[model samples]
Target: MTSSLMRKGSRPLRLPLLIAALAFSGAAAHAEDEPGSLPRSFPVATPAVAALPAAPTLGADIAGLLEQARASNPGFAAQRAETAAARERTDSAGALPDPNFQVELMDFTNQMRGGGTTLVPGRVGETRYRVIQALPGWGKRDLQTRSAAAKAEQAAAGLDAAWLDLALTIKQAWLRYYAADREAALARESLALLGGLEEATLARYRQGLVPQQAVLRAQREITTQRIAQVGIGQRRRGAAAALNGILARSPDAPLAAPAEPAALPSALDLPALIARARAANPAITADERGIDAARLERERTFADRYPDYSVGVTNNRARGENQTWDVMFEVMIPLQQSARRAREREATQMLAAADARREATASRLAGELGSAWSTFTSAQETRRLIRGTLLPQAQATRDASRAAFETGRVDFDAVLEAERQLVDTRTSLLQAEIEARTALFEIEKLVGETP
Candidate 1:
């Protein structure tokens, strides 16, 4: 009778315990069905550490990048070094050849006769001292000096061009990094939103308020977003690697997310931009210097055909009574030498080549200016449109869909669609920003100054 009473008392507790165990089991099963469950052997990606330290936090501005390039970029440094070396050569032109000095003994008595030496003018054992100097061709040194100076100037301009190109490249890489970060963030947010929708839909289905099809659709979206996230993440990683490469770091080094580019200032008139480019652009200046150098070289080469004068003093002692000293000036007139003809021909060819190159460079820069100008204008318009209209519309649509879904008027599919639209719009805006930044870099590169 006591055992029967205990059994009746335990029935309520036993039923509740059984119900709780069943609920826990169902929750576990649902979690197992969820995507992104840690795999039995989920492979964690090891951090890439084979590369070097982070790039020095030189400001991300163009000027900072340019300065770094001048210091560390081998090509630019080589050009600057060349300029320095060329300028040093100009000192060679004005340098006079070493003056020669001579000393000799003169005898007034016949040494063969064993005569006594006399210390007097035109006497035996008299010592004579003299010096001599060589005169270079008239204006030859001046022309050579000018030519060397021009060459040095040309090299300096080339270095400037190198710096400008490097600055633009860094800016482009920075913009690319920003784009990658933006896209990756969007992908991550979409993935999280899809996962949340999957959980909500699963709950609704369990309550019998929504069909199993809704749960399946949410799962599909989660899978799709996960795939997109992976893809964007890979792209972001690649972009980071590229940024490291630009900073002269190993390509695998981890990089901090780059900042967005600053807003572009109001556009400059094309005419003004072109004028500034012509005056200050390194490529154009280099060509101009090259033309001047070529002219100087031509003049110097022509001067090479002229005669050079050498003045010297000579003393003769005959081992006898007779001795003499004479001062002489000699002119080495180079007759119609084959070398002169060759040099003239060479100079003519070089002058023609320089002229042609200058023209080509100018034409190329002009075309580039035009293209960059057009791109800047177009990107500005696109950026304005995105900021003013498209982004707002996408945001509004997404907000409306969220409200509808909360009120149970719209389905989970509508929410996913709205979310996808919002992500796309954001990505497009990022692209527009990148385009504008790239255009600005191009303008600065061509103009050699900020626009």
Candidate 2:
């Protein structure tokens, strides 16, 4: 063809090509939506699931499940029960010990030889009845009560820690589900875009405007996207199963995809966060209580090395004389000084161990909080970069490449590459957003609120 003829032929195609490329850009932009909503599937929605009472929203469902677990999860319920029992024991620790009752038959045996009129008696039989009570060494009972109360506090702290951990687990599982669902959707969108490009490329190849290799490349990308879709679907199912396990449901239970997590909390001062964790973190509280309990036990054990006494009032019935009452007292002395020393050493060692554990736990928790804070900040920064800079720039690149390809100034490969880059950036943004929120959940677990 002549030069002018070639230019004229290309001129007619430029408008149509530009229109198609613009449509491609529009589709890429539309592929991603508000993170809060992702389409989820029910592979085989069971009749039981369908028949349940009004289905709760995702957040509501999570909240309700957490509440249910307080009574349903065996581990949590057991810990709660232990806490209650310990609290009950604290009340009994300071109360007076139960009294002992005794009855004695004295001089009641019958004689074999009966020289007198009465054949059965050597003397008039007397019955004695008594009640006895033990008084703990001074300060021992009080120490016991204090120790019990402190241990009760420990149990309560342990339960609180378990509850916080449960919340963290739920948040992580929910985020995974959300991420998987988003990944699957993006894969499908990419597949559709590639399908459209494949059709367009085949048309141009047939017209001898583009080599057949372009058509094959588009087809290859479509197949790759399809494989990714399959993998993402599997991940979604696995994530959903894990979430259902937390909810105490069957493994195959269906769930509505969780909505976007709430935004990350405002940036926090790391030192302030560590201080909050020191004060409010349940594990630390539990350990501190353990130390108090151990110290009280050590003091009580030292007091126990003294002696406890028993006192009683006895009523005696005597046929030969008038009935009489007598008072009795007994004292128990600790003769095993070595054993007492051993007990003291055990309590001392236990107290030392508890102190060490508390320090280690606090230090570890502070370090963990710092790490989570860093990760959260990184994710937040990455998401902001993708949204404010990377995504828009990628769109512009796609648009520019499409303009070049339409005028035969660039290959179709450049436009495809730009589109893929945009999809990838969008995916990364979604993942970073989830990671940031998950880290925020971890901090909340430690600090009693978002740090």
Candidate 3:
């Protein structure tokens, strides 16, 4: 039975091997049929070394950067274009309708049969020409133009909002890059100090004053600091790249550090902040314009239920003959009640939706303002703590630990630990400062500060 089972398994394996052999033979034959053919892979560039010029950094101030971003950002530029188009549409809404021209040449006969005798026709062709134009009903053009103008104003406000958003993003990116630069510097400083400690430990060990273990520990710390410096440098580079990207630079562009801030306001009153935000916030203005647009649209659409009238003159001339003119009036009746009804309903729905959106936007803005205020407050508190208490205490501890270690009072490990603590405290202080600046930026952006 065992021999039979082995034979069955071996038979199946032979069939697979035969199939594999067939596939391999087919592949070999195909390769031989195609002479001097490279295997499929990524295509080589037609021109080697597509050297591109290094992109220039704007190195512009915050205001100038915001302006550049406004021009470069697709969203902001598109909104600006849309606003201009809407303005043109508003003008068109108030313009007169196109005129229509008509001409007709009536019968001109060379001869007329009168009592079986040929007679020339005395009166020739009667030619008529008319210019027809549709004159809008009273206030119709005004209403239509008003509606379009309101929409255009809304678009302008929308552009302002886009600008605000781009400015906020730029500010955040700049602050982050600045923080990365500072952190890199700190890491380098720490590495240098660790190197000095490492050398001192080796010298003491050589003098038979410290153990080999102490020297090895200091060496390890220096190595770790070097590694940290490398990582921090990479982070700084990444941050710089991001800042350049925000300014619409190519990947290879070099961006200068952001300008240092002179100072920040110590405190901002909540009432004043809210009032300024209300005055400058594009979202609120957009909502207001939207309301106006919806109201005008409703009125205009209702007015459409009535008929419009036109008046023009008709003229006729043939072969430089005397011209003839006829004055006439025309009126179109709105007989499609269903279409009118649908338009009114559509306008009503749009108006309601706009109002609802406005309410929602107001609610959302309030929440955002509250959060921003809280964050700014908390960051301020953190900065105060770091400056007045935490950093100074950490610095004192590190100094005392170093002195004690020098006097053979404390171990080298304790001194290293104090140094690490001091570094951590300083790092935290930098972080808090960055957070405070970022929070201020957010609050100002939400409040629509220009710079």
Candidate 4:
């Protein structure tokens, strides 16, 4: 009984091998009967190089856009207005205070003469018309003028800073828009390639040269590319909206395609850039102006210790008496010593704070420049490597895999993976390009490059 059971199990195992052998033989016979029925290789699709948009002339388009933004952006306009207002304030800061005019009816009741009170100045015992001018302490006006001038300088520097910031933002936004636009174009190109592959795969499926799964995979890839294209389109629109917002345009406004960015200036060594920042960076300049203003304010505070005076001329008229002129002078006494001392201390602290702020701004800008320089160099190297080495390699691998798939030497998954790798490498190159340009723009902003 045990031998009988073992024989039954062995027969079941041998039956599968026999059937498999026959099926292989039948497939071989079928292939032999239909000569040249299967495709030996599929057409290799060559993708375009992942490059930025071409320009006939570098920097012209972007420069014009920046100028438009500067001219139309409301925020920048407000900043310019603020600077103008500050300049106007400097003119009035040192001007003399308005003079005081006084009309006095001395002894209006005339009690000493036993007369009734009178509201009329002419009927009073004595009427005086006085004009008085208060004078600030020595050197106070000059110090105030200098302080106001410094403040005006600070405002001008602030305007410069605003412009730098806006320019940087505009540059970055433009770059983002360019990258998205290019990526969308690439996606469309990829989709077209995939569509061809899908058609070829369906033909192979119909001929029974390849499995149905291959056709499904090709179709899936085409669909996925379409999905990615949708995403890229969304990103492109978002970037366009941001750029349009910067230019004070409607979100849905049409825009020209972006051109390639200009190369960095030949003189833009790191050390030279740092020097430029020191000399031209608006934040540092503003801080320096703040220090000057604070120093002048401190001096003016100390000058407050000196007394201010007022001079007056009076025209006196008395009833039944000749008109007379009187000259008067008054001096201000600085009696609040504690308050004045506190103010002096406050001014001193403010001056020190301003000095500290300048140092801090310089240090911070140096660190930012260093970071941007590092990023710029790294992105440039990455882009070069991808463009020169990785992109070509990926494309070659994809073509080889596709050929192998057609000849039945490799699986369909390998071909799909190769395509994905090629796409990813191209994307990485695009990102690297964007990063390098963005870092360059950051450096320009740090150095306060004007439009």
Estimated TM-score for each candidate: 0.73, 0.79, 0.77, 0.84
Q: Which predicted model would earn the best TM-score?
A: 4
User: What is the C-alpha local distance difference test score of each model?
Assistant: 0.76, 0.80, 0.77, 0.86
Model 2: per-residue lDDT, tens digit, 1-451?
4563356536434557878999997666557433543433324343454555765454333564566555666666777888899899999988888999887756554232222333232243666779999998888889999999999999988888988887778777777888888788788888877787788788778888889888888888888888888889999889878877776778786576666555566576889989999998989999999999999999998898889989999988754667789899999989989989999999999999999999999999988999999998898889888999999999899778867866778898897998799899889888888888888888888786521
What ranking emerges by lDDT with the best candidate at the front? Answer: 4, 2, 3, 1
lDDT of 1: 0.76
* C-alpha lDDT of candidate 2 relative to the true structure: 0.80
lDDT of 2 at 199: 82
How many pairs collide in each candidate, listed in order?
3, 0, 1, 0
Write down the TM-score for model 3. 0.77
Give the alpha carbon lDDT tens digit for every residue of 197-302 in model 3: 7776777678877789998898888888888878877877777677667766775576665566657666667667777777878888899899999999999889
Task: Give the candidate number with the greatest lDDT.
Answer: 4
Clashing pairs in 2: none
C-alpha displacement of 64 in model 4, angstroms?
A: 2.4
